[model samples]
Target: MSRTTVLPVTRRATIVGAAVVLAVVALSGCAGTSGSAPEARQSPSKSQSSQSSQSSSPSSAERTPAPTKTTDAAAAATDLTFEDGAALSASTLPAFGLEVSALDGWEQTGEDSSVGSREYTKSDGSVATITQQRITDLDPSMGDRAATEQLFTAAGMPAEQLEEQLLPTMTGGTAQFLSIAGHTTDGSWSATVARAFAKPGAALIVKVQTPSQETLRPDLHDILVHAQVVLT
Candidate 1:
Protein backbone atom coordinates (compact mmCIF):
# COMPACT_ATOMS: atom_id res chain seq x y z
CA MET A 1 0.00 0.00 0.00
CA SER A 2 1.10 3.56 -0.64
CA ARG A 3 1.31 5.27 2.73
CA THR A 4 1.68 9.05 2.64
CA THR A 5 3.65 10.31 5.62
CA VAL A 6 2.57 13.95 5.76
CA LEU A 7 4.52 15.68 8.53
CA PRO A 8 4.03 19.05 10.24
CA VAL A 9 6.55 21.86 10.70
CA THR A 10 7.88 24.24 13.38
CA ARG A 11 8.93 27.89 13.45
CA ARG A 12 12.44 27.19 14.74
CA ALA A 13 13.01 24.55 12.09
CA THR A 14 11.91 26.97 9.40
CA ILE A 15 14.83 29.19 10.44
CA VAL A 16 17.66 26.67 10.15
CA GLY A 17 16.02 24.30 7.68
CA ALA A 18 14.45 27.06 5.66
CA ALA A 19 15.72 25.84 2.34
CA VAL A 20 14.84 22.18 2.82
CA VAL A 21 11.37 22.70 4.33
CA LEU A 22 10.39 25.34 1.79
CA ALA A 23 10.93 23.01 -1.15
CA VAL A 24 9.63 19.83 0.44
CA VAL A 25 6.62 21.54 1.98
CA ALA A 26 5.40 22.82 -1.35
CA LEU A 27 5.54 19.49 -3.16
CA SER A 28 4.24 17.48 -0.24
CA GLY A 29 1.88 20.01 1.38
CA CYS A 30 3.27 18.45 4.53
CA ALA A 31 3.10 21.88 6.11
CA GLY A 32 1.29 20.81 9.23
CA THR A 33 -2.06 21.95 10.64
CA SER A 34 -3.57 22.22 14.16
CA GLY A 35 -6.95 20.52 13.73
CA SER A 36 -8.55 17.48 12.14
CA ALA A 37 -10.11 19.57 9.38
CA PRO A 38 -8.87 19.12 5.82
CA GLU A 39 -6.62 21.58 4.03
CA ALA A 40 -7.80 24.53 1.91
CA ARG A 41 -10.04 24.06 -1.09
CA GLN A 42 -9.64 25.70 -4.51
CA SER A 43 -13.26 26.54 -5.30
CA PRO A 44 -16.01 28.51 -3.58
CA SER A 45 -19.62 27.60 -2.86
CA LYS A 46 -22.92 29.02 -4.18
CA SER A 47 -23.96 30.39 -0.81
CA GLN A 48 -20.62 32.07 -0.46
CA SER A 49 -20.94 33.59 -3.92
CA SER A 50 -24.44 34.83 -3.27
CA GLN A 51 -23.44 36.31 0.04
CA SER A 52 -20.43 37.99 -1.53
CA SER A 53 -22.52 39.45 -4.27
CA GLN A 54 -25.03 40.79 -1.83
CA SER A 55 -22.35 42.35 0.34
CA SER A 56 -20.43 43.82 -2.55
CA SER A 57 -23.44 44.94 -4.54
CA PRO A 58 -24.18 48.61 -4.04
CA SER A 59 -27.43 49.80 -2.52
CA SER A 60 -29.72 52.14 -4.47
CA ALA A 61 -28.54 55.28 -2.63
CA GLU A 62 -24.92 54.16 -2.56
CA ARG A 63 -24.98 52.82 -6.13
CA THR A 64 -22.20 54.76 -7.78
CA PRO A 65 -21.55 51.93 -10.27
CA ALA A 66 -21.20 48.19 -10.52
CA PRO A 67 -18.58 46.90 -8.14
CA THR A 68 -15.50 46.13 -10.16
CA LYS A 69 -14.11 42.68 -9.66
CA THR A 70 -11.18 43.04 -7.32
CA THR A 71 -8.50 40.48 -6.62
CA ASP A 72 -7.05 39.47 -3.27
CA ALA A 73 -3.72 38.12 -2.01
CA ALA A 74 -4.51 34.49 -2.79
CA ALA A 75 -5.15 35.63 -6.32
CA ALA A 76 -1.58 36.87 -6.39
CA ALA A 77 0.11 33.49 -5.84
CA THR A 78 0.46 31.65 -9.13
CA ASP A 79 1.10 27.99 -9.88
CA LEU A 80 4.07 27.38 -12.11
CA THR A 81 6.20 24.66 -13.74
CA PHE A 82 9.95 24.75 -14.27
CA GLU A 83 12.57 23.03 -16.45
CA ASP A 84 15.03 22.39 -13.63
CA GLY A 85 13.33 19.10 -12.88
CA ALA A 86 11.11 20.99 -10.45
CA ALA A 87 7.36 20.52 -10.43
CA LEU A 88 5.20 23.22 -8.83
CA SER A 89 1.45 23.36 -8.32
CA ALA A 90 -0.71 26.10 -6.73
CA SER A 91 -4.25 26.38 -5.53
CA THR A 92 -6.12 29.41 -4.15
CA LEU A 93 -7.72 29.44 -0.71
CA PRO A 94 -9.92 32.52 -0.72
CA ALA A 95 -7.75 35.16 0.97
CA PHE A 96 -4.80 32.79 1.19
CA GLY A 97 -2.95 30.39 -1.13
CA LEU A 98 -1.10 27.06 -1.15
CA GLU A 99 1.83 26.12 -3.39
CA VAL A 100 4.14 23.11 -3.89
CA SER A 101 7.27 22.33 -5.94
CA ALA A 102 9.53 19.29 -6.18
CA LEU A 103 12.37 17.88 -8.24
CA ASP A 104 11.95 15.46 -11.12
CA GLY A 105 11.79 11.65 -10.80
CA TRP A 106 9.44 11.85 -7.83
CA GLU A 107 6.68 9.38 -8.62
CA GLN A 108 3.05 10.53 -8.31
CA THR A 109 0.44 8.46 -6.55
CA GLY A 110 -3.22 8.69 -5.53
CA GLU A 111 -4.33 9.04 -1.92
CA ASP A 112 -7.50 8.64 0.09
CA SER A 113 -10.07 11.41 -0.51
CA SER A 114 -9.98 12.56 3.12
CA VAL A 115 -9.09 16.29 3.39
CA GLY A 116 -8.70 16.12 -0.38
CA SER A 117 -4.97 15.46 0.11
CA ARG A 118 -2.93 14.18 -2.84
CA GLU A 119 0.12 11.98 -2.37
CA TYR A 120 3.70 12.27 -3.63
CA THR A 121 7.17 10.75 -3.20
CA LYS A 122 9.70 11.80 -0.56
CA SER A 123 13.45 12.02 -1.11
CA ASP A 124 13.94 8.84 0.93
CA GLY A 125 11.37 7.05 -1.26
CA SER A 126 8.54 7.70 1.15
CA VAL A 127 5.07 9.18 0.49
CA ALA A 128 3.71 12.61 1.47
CA THR A 129 0.64 14.80 1.06
CA ILE A 130 -0.39 18.40 0.20
CA THR A 131 -3.13 20.35 2.01
CA GLN A 132 -4.89 23.75 2.06
CA GLN A 133 -6.32 25.91 4.85
CA ARG A 134 -6.76 29.39 6.37
CA ILE A 135 -4.12 31.67 7.88
CA THR A 136 -5.97 31.70 11.18
CA ASP A 137 -5.09 28.07 11.77
CA LEU A 138 -1.39 28.74 11.25
CA ASP A 139 -1.44 31.61 13.76
CA PRO A 140 -4.69 33.21 14.77
CA SER A 141 -3.42 36.71 15.49
CA MET A 142 -1.06 37.21 12.58
CA GLY A 143 -2.15 37.32 8.96
CA ASP A 144 -0.36 35.58 6.09
CA ARG A 145 2.49 38.09 5.93
CA ALA A 146 3.11 37.93 9.68
CA ALA A 147 2.86 34.15 9.77
CA THR A 148 5.39 33.91 6.94
CA GLU A 149 7.61 36.25 8.88
CA GLN A 150 7.41 34.00 11.93
CA LEU A 151 8.32 31.01 9.80
CA PHE A 152 11.31 32.85 8.38
CA THR A 153 12.40 33.90 11.83
CA ALA A 154 12.11 30.34 13.10
CA ALA A 155 13.84 28.98 10.00
CA GLY A 156 16.67 31.42 10.60
CA MET A 157 16.21 32.53 7.02
CA PRO A 158 18.81 34.94 5.71
CA ALA A 159 16.09 36.38 3.52
CA GLU A 160 14.54 37.92 6.60
CA GLN A 161 16.49 41.11 6.13
CA LEU A 162 15.04 41.19 2.68
CA GLU A 163 11.61 41.05 4.22
CA GLU A 164 12.18 44.41 5.88
CA GLN A 165 13.80 45.63 2.67
CA LEU A 166 10.90 44.33 0.62
CA LEU A 167 8.18 45.10 3.08
CA PRO A 168 6.07 46.74 0.38
CA THR A 169 6.36 43.62 -1.75
CA MET A 170 4.92 41.22 0.81
CA THR A 171 1.17 40.91 1.33
CA GLY A 172 -0.95 41.06 4.47
CA GLY A 173 -4.21 39.22 4.14
CA THR A 174 -6.81 38.22 6.71
CA ALA A 175 -6.11 34.57 6.01
CA GLN A 176 -2.80 34.36 4.23
CA PHE A 177 -0.28 33.34 6.90
CA LEU A 178 0.42 29.60 6.73
CA SER A 179 1.38 27.27 9.61
CA ILE A 180 3.71 24.59 8.35
CA ALA A 181 5.05 21.48 10.06
CA GLY A 182 3.68 19.45 12.98
CA HIS A 183 6.52 19.23 15.47
CA THR A 184 7.95 21.28 18.31
CA THR A 185 10.64 23.94 17.91
CA ASP A 186 13.19 21.17 18.27
CA GLY A 187 13.81 18.82 15.29
CA SER A 188 13.74 15.43 17.01
CA TRP A 189 10.18 14.34 16.13
CA SER A 190 7.48 15.21 13.53
CA ALA A 191 3.66 15.34 13.42
CA THR A 192 1.16 16.27 10.70
CA VAL A 193 -1.35 19.19 10.43
CA ALA A 194 -4.53 17.88 8.96
CA ARG A 195 -7.61 19.70 7.57
CA ALA A 196 -5.66 22.91 7.47
CA PHE A 197 -7.17 26.12 6.03
CA ALA A 198 -10.50 27.31 7.30
CA LYS A 199 -12.77 27.85 4.31
CA PRO A 200 -14.09 31.42 3.82
CA GLY A 201 -10.51 32.02 4.86
CA ALA A 202 -7.13 30.84 3.50
CA ALA A 203 -6.19 27.55 1.77
CA LEU A 204 -3.47 25.77 -0.20
CA ILE A 205 -0.79 23.81 1.71
CA VAL A 206 1.87 21.12 1.11
CA LYS A 207 2.75 18.09 3.17
CA VAL A 208 6.07 16.27 3.62
CA GLN A 209 7.06 12.90 5.07
CA THR A 210 10.38 14.03 6.43
CA PRO A 211 11.88 17.31 7.60
CA SER A 212 14.99 18.32 5.68
CA GLN A 213 16.00 21.91 6.41
CA GLU A 214 18.68 21.56 3.75
CA THR A 215 16.43 20.35 0.94
CA LEU A 216 13.31 22.46 1.52
CA ARG A 217 14.42 26.08 2.01
CA PRO A 218 16.04 27.20 -1.24
CA ASP A 219 13.10 26.01 -3.28
CA LEU A 220 10.75 27.90 -0.99
CA HIS A 221 12.74 31.07 -1.49
CA ASP A 222 12.68 30.57 -5.24
CA ILE A 223 8.95 30.02 -5.26
CA LEU A 224 8.21 33.13 -3.15
CA VAL A 225 10.59 35.16 -5.27
CA HIS A 226 8.92 34.04 -8.47
CA ALA A 227 5.36 33.85 -7.24
CA GLN A 228 2.81 36.25 -8.80
CA VAL A 229 -0.89 36.74 -8.46
CA VAL A 230 -3.18 34.71 -10.72
CA LEU A 231 -6.62 36.37 -10.80
CA THR A 232 -8.35 33.62 -12.65
Candidate 2:
Protein backbone atom coordinates (compact mmCIF):
# COMPACT_ATOMS: atom_id res chain seq x y z
CA MET A 1 0.00 0.00 0.00
CA SER A 2 1.20 3.49 -0.87
CA ARG A 3 1.19 5.90 2.05
CA THR A 4 0.30 9.24 0.56
CA THR A 5 -0.46 12.33 2.64
CA VAL A 6 -2.24 15.14 0.83
CA LEU A 7 -1.42 18.67 1.86
CA PRO A 8 -4.10 21.09 0.74
CA VAL A 9 -2.84 23.73 -1.68
CA THR A 10 -4.07 27.23 -1.08
CA ARG A 11 -4.88 29.19 -4.20
CA ARG A 12 -6.03 32.63 -5.23
CA ALA A 13 -9.51 33.38 -3.92
CA THR A 14 -10.12 35.52 -6.97
CA ILE A 15 -9.76 32.47 -9.18
CA VAL A 16 -11.00 29.59 -7.04
CA GLY A 17 -13.29 29.23 -4.08
CA ALA A 18 -11.98 28.07 -0.71
CA ALA A 19 -13.70 24.73 -1.32
CA VAL A 20 -11.97 24.29 -4.66
CA VAL A 21 -8.67 25.44 -3.23
CA LEU A 22 -8.73 22.97 -0.35
CA ALA A 23 -10.05 20.38 -2.71
CA VAL A 24 -6.85 20.59 -4.70
CA VAL A 25 -5.04 18.93 -1.81
CA ALA A 26 -7.81 16.55 -0.75
CA LEU A 27 -8.33 15.31 -4.29
CA SER A 28 -4.66 15.03 -5.16
CA GLY A 29 -4.41 11.81 -3.19
CA CYS A 30 -7.41 10.36 -4.94
CA ALA A 31 -6.78 11.32 -8.56
CA GLY A 32 -3.05 11.48 -9.10
CA THR A 33 -1.89 10.09 -12.42
CA SER A 34 0.79 7.44 -12.92
CA GLY A 35 4.05 8.56 -11.28
CA SER A 36 2.68 12.01 -10.44
CA ALA A 37 3.76 13.50 -7.14
CA PRO A 38 0.59 14.74 -5.40
CA GLU A 39 2.43 17.35 -3.40
CA ALA A 40 5.13 18.27 -5.87
CA ARG A 41 2.66 19.22 -8.55
CA GLN A 42 0.70 21.58 -6.34
CA SER A 43 1.21 25.30 -6.82
CA PRO A 44 2.33 27.58 -4.01
CA SER A 45 -0.12 28.29 -1.20
CA LYS A 46 -2.70 30.99 -1.85
CA SER A 47 -1.20 33.17 0.88
CA GLN A 48 2.06 33.28 -1.04
CA SER A 49 2.04 36.03 -3.58
CA SER A 50 2.83 34.90 -7.10
CA GLN A 51 4.36 37.02 -9.83
CA SER A 52 1.48 38.88 -11.45
CA SER A 53 2.68 37.83 -14.88
CA GLN A 54 2.50 34.18 -13.89
CA SER A 55 -0.37 32.30 -15.45
CA SER A 56 -3.40 33.84 -13.76
CA SER A 57 -5.79 31.43 -15.33
CA PRO A 58 -6.98 28.67 -12.98
CA SER A 59 -8.38 26.55 -15.80
CA SER A 60 -5.15 26.28 -17.77
CA ALA A 61 -2.48 26.54 -15.08
CA GLU A 62 -3.89 24.90 -11.96
CA ARG A 63 -5.96 22.13 -13.49
CA THR A 64 -5.27 18.49 -12.72
CA PRO A 65 -5.59 15.76 -15.28
CA ALA A 66 -9.16 14.62 -15.77
CA PRO A 67 -10.13 10.93 -15.58
CA THR A 68 -11.21 9.95 -19.03
CA LYS A 69 -12.33 6.59 -20.42
CA THR A 70 -9.56 4.23 -19.48
CA THR A 71 -8.11 1.51 -21.59
CA ASP A 72 -8.44 -2.13 -20.49
CA ALA A 73 -4.88 -2.08 -19.25
CA ALA A 74 -5.40 1.27 -17.57
CA ALA A 75 -8.65 0.27 -15.94
CA ALA A 76 -7.11 -2.96 -14.73
CA ALA A 77 -4.25 -0.94 -13.32
CA THR A 78 -6.50 1.53 -11.49
CA ASP A 79 -6.84 0.74 -7.79
CA LEU A 80 -10.55 1.05 -7.08
CA THR A 81 -11.67 -2.05 -5.22
CA PHE A 82 -14.95 -2.09 -3.32
CA GLU A 83 -17.04 -5.10 -2.39
CA ASP A 84 -20.68 -4.17 -2.83
CA GLY A 85 -20.32 -1.17 -0.58
CA ALA A 86 -17.38 -2.48 1.39
CA ALA A 87 -16.87 0.94 2.93
CA LEU A 88 -20.57 1.63 3.36
CA SER A 89 -22.78 -1.37 2.67
CA ALA A 90 -25.73 -0.65 0.42
CA SER A 91 -28.03 -2.83 2.54
CA THR A 92 -27.77 -0.49 5.52
CA LEU A 93 -28.60 2.54 3.44
CA PRO A 94 -31.70 4.60 2.83
CA ALA A 95 -33.03 5.24 -0.66
CA PHE A 96 -30.74 7.67 -2.50
CA GLY A 97 -28.61 8.12 -5.61
CA LEU A 98 -24.88 7.37 -5.79
CA GLU A 99 -22.14 6.96 -8.36
CA VAL A 100 -18.58 5.67 -7.94
CA SER A 101 -15.78 4.40 -10.12
CA ALA A 102 -12.38 2.77 -10.03
CA LEU A 103 -9.85 5.30 -11.19
CA ASP A 104 -6.28 4.97 -12.46
CA GLY A 105 -3.13 6.22 -10.73
CA TRP A 106 -4.65 5.46 -7.33
CA GLU A 107 -2.47 3.66 -4.82
CA GLN A 108 -3.09 1.84 -1.53
CA THR A 109 -1.15 2.68 1.61
CA GLY A 110 -0.54 1.42 5.14
CA GLU A 111 -3.51 2.99 6.82
CA ASP A 112 -5.38 0.37 8.80
CA SER A 113 -7.63 -1.76 6.62
CA SER A 114 -6.69 0.18 3.53
CA VAL A 115 -6.13 3.74 2.30
CA GLY A 116 -6.21 4.80 -1.31
CA SER A 117 -6.56 8.07 -3.22
CA ARG A 118 -7.70 8.71 -6.78
CA GLU A 119 -9.29 11.37 -8.91
CA TYR A 120 -12.57 11.40 -10.81
CA THR A 121 -13.15 13.33 -14.00
CA LYS A 122 -16.57 14.65 -14.84
CA SER A 123 -18.32 17.51 -16.67
CA ASP A 124 -16.64 16.72 -19.95
CA GLY A 125 -13.33 16.31 -18.22
CA SER A 126 -13.37 19.91 -17.17
CA VAL A 127 -13.96 19.06 -13.52
CA ALA A 128 -11.81 16.70 -11.47
CA THR A 129 -12.27 14.89 -8.12
CA ILE A 130 -9.95 13.30 -5.61
CA THR A 131 -11.17 10.66 -3.16
CA GLN A 132 -9.52 9.17 -0.10
CA GLN A 133 -10.54 6.10 1.93
CA ARG A 134 -9.21 4.86 5.25
CA ILE A 135 -10.57 1.75 6.93
CA THR A 136 -10.35 1.65 10.73
CA ASP A 137 -11.55 -0.34 13.75
CA LEU A 138 -13.72 2.08 15.68
CA ASP A 139 -17.46 1.63 15.99
CA PRO A 140 -20.00 4.22 17.05
CA SER A 141 -21.77 3.94 20.42
CA MET A 142 -23.06 6.08 23.25
CA GLY A 143 -19.65 6.16 24.88
CA ASP A 144 -17.73 6.84 21.68
CA ARG A 145 -20.18 9.39 20.33
CA ALA A 146 -18.50 12.13 22.31
CA ALA A 147 -15.13 11.51 20.74
CA THR A 148 -16.77 11.15 17.36
CA GLU A 149 -18.60 14.41 17.88
CA GLN A 150 -15.35 16.14 18.62
CA LEU A 151 -13.79 14.89 15.41
CA PHE A 152 -16.80 15.91 13.40
CA THR A 153 -16.94 19.27 15.07
CA ALA A 154 -13.40 19.97 13.97
CA ALA A 155 -13.78 18.60 10.48
CA GLY A 156 -17.22 20.08 10.03
CA MET A 157 -15.98 23.67 9.63
CA PRO A 158 -14.37 23.12 6.23
CA ALA A 159 -17.37 21.08 5.16
CA GLU A 160 -19.85 23.73 6.22
CA GLN A 161 -17.87 26.59 4.77
CA LEU A 162 -17.59 24.73 1.50
CA GLU A 163 -21.32 24.06 1.46
CA GLU A 164 -22.20 27.63 2.29
CA GLN A 165 -20.02 28.85 -0.55
CA LEU A 166 -21.65 26.35 -2.83
CA LEU A 167 -25.30 27.00 -1.90
CA PRO A 168 -25.57 30.27 -3.71
CA THR A 169 -23.86 28.86 -6.77
CA MET A 170 -26.33 25.97 -6.62
CA THR A 171 -29.41 26.37 -8.77
CA GLY A 172 -32.59 24.38 -9.46
CA GLY A 173 -33.48 21.95 -6.62
CA THR A 174 -34.48 23.28 -3.22
CA ALA A 175 -31.58 23.78 -0.81
CA GLN A 176 -32.58 22.94 2.73
CA PHE A 177 -30.67 22.09 5.88
CA LEU A 178 -30.27 18.32 6.17
CA SER A 179 -32.10 17.28 9.34
CA ILE A 180 -31.88 13.54 9.74
CA ALA A 181 -34.00 11.63 12.22
CA GLY A 182 -31.02 11.27 14.56
CA HIS A 183 -28.60 14.02 13.64
CA THR A 184 -28.27 17.77 13.45
CA THR A 185 -25.79 20.53 12.49
CA ASP A 186 -25.31 24.29 12.92
CA GLY A 187 -26.79 24.68 9.44
CA SER A 188 -24.37 23.48 6.75
CA TRP A 189 -24.46 21.38 3.60
CA SER A 190 -21.58 19.10 4.53
CA ALA A 191 -22.73 15.64 5.66
CA THR A 192 -21.42 14.32 8.94
CA VAL A 193 -22.00 10.67 9.74
CA ALA A 194 -23.99 10.52 12.99
CA ARG A 195 -24.04 6.77 13.61
CA ALA A 196 -23.03 3.48 12.10
CA PHE A 197 -22.95 -0.23 12.92
CA ALA A 198 -19.44 -0.80 11.71
CA LYS A 199 -16.41 0.39 13.66
CA PRO A 200 -14.55 2.45 11.07
CA GLY A 201 -16.68 3.67 8.17
CA ALA A 202 -16.32 5.20 4.74
CA ALA A 203 -17.04 8.75 3.58
CA LEU A 204 -17.09 10.18 0.07
CA ILE A 205 -17.40 13.87 -0.69
CA VAL A 206 -17.30 15.62 -4.06
CA LYS A 207 -16.28 19.25 -4.64
CA VAL A 208 -17.85 20.68 -7.70
CA GLN A 209 -19.57 23.92 -8.54
CA THR A 210 -22.86 23.38 -6.78
CA PRO A 211 -24.90 21.20 -9.07
CA SER A 212 -28.63 21.56 -9.56
CA GLN A 213 -30.65 21.42 -6.32
CA GLU A 214 -32.14 18.07 -7.31
CA THR A 215 -28.79 16.55 -8.24
CA LEU A 216 -26.92 17.94 -5.22
CA ARG A 217 -29.47 16.80 -2.62
CA PRO A 218 -29.86 13.23 -3.82
CA ASP A 219 -26.19 12.70 -4.58
CA LEU A 220 -25.06 13.87 -1.15
CA HIS A 221 -27.95 12.16 0.63
CA ASP A 222 -27.13 8.83 -0.92
CA ILE A 223 -23.45 9.11 -0.04
CA LEU A 224 -24.19 10.18 3.55
CA VAL A 225 -27.01 7.70 4.25
CA HIS A 226 -25.01 4.85 2.77
CA ALA A 227 -21.98 5.69 4.90
CA GLN A 228 -21.72 2.73 7.27
CA VAL A 229 -19.15 0.50 8.90
CA VAL A 230 -18.44 -2.33 6.48
CA LEU A 231 -14.69 -2.74 6.18
CA THR A 232 -13.38 -5.15 8.77
lDDT of 1 by residue, 1-232 (tens): 3222322222111122323223222224322221322232121233653465457633444422222453332323232111100111223322112233322335557654434345656455444444432333444333334444454454543232311111001122112223343333435222222122222233333344445444443323322221212222
Best by lDDT: 1
lDDT by residue (tens digit), candidate 2, 1-232 = 4232331221111111121222111211111222221111112322321332144423322332323542222112111111111232322211112123122322222122122223333332212232333224333332222322333334432333221101100011111111111111321222222221222242322332223322333333222222211111
Q: Against the true structure, what is each candidate's TM-score?
A: 0.32, 0.26
Alpha carbon lDDT of each predicted model: 0.31, 0.23
Give lDDT: candidate 2, residue 93.
Answer: 19
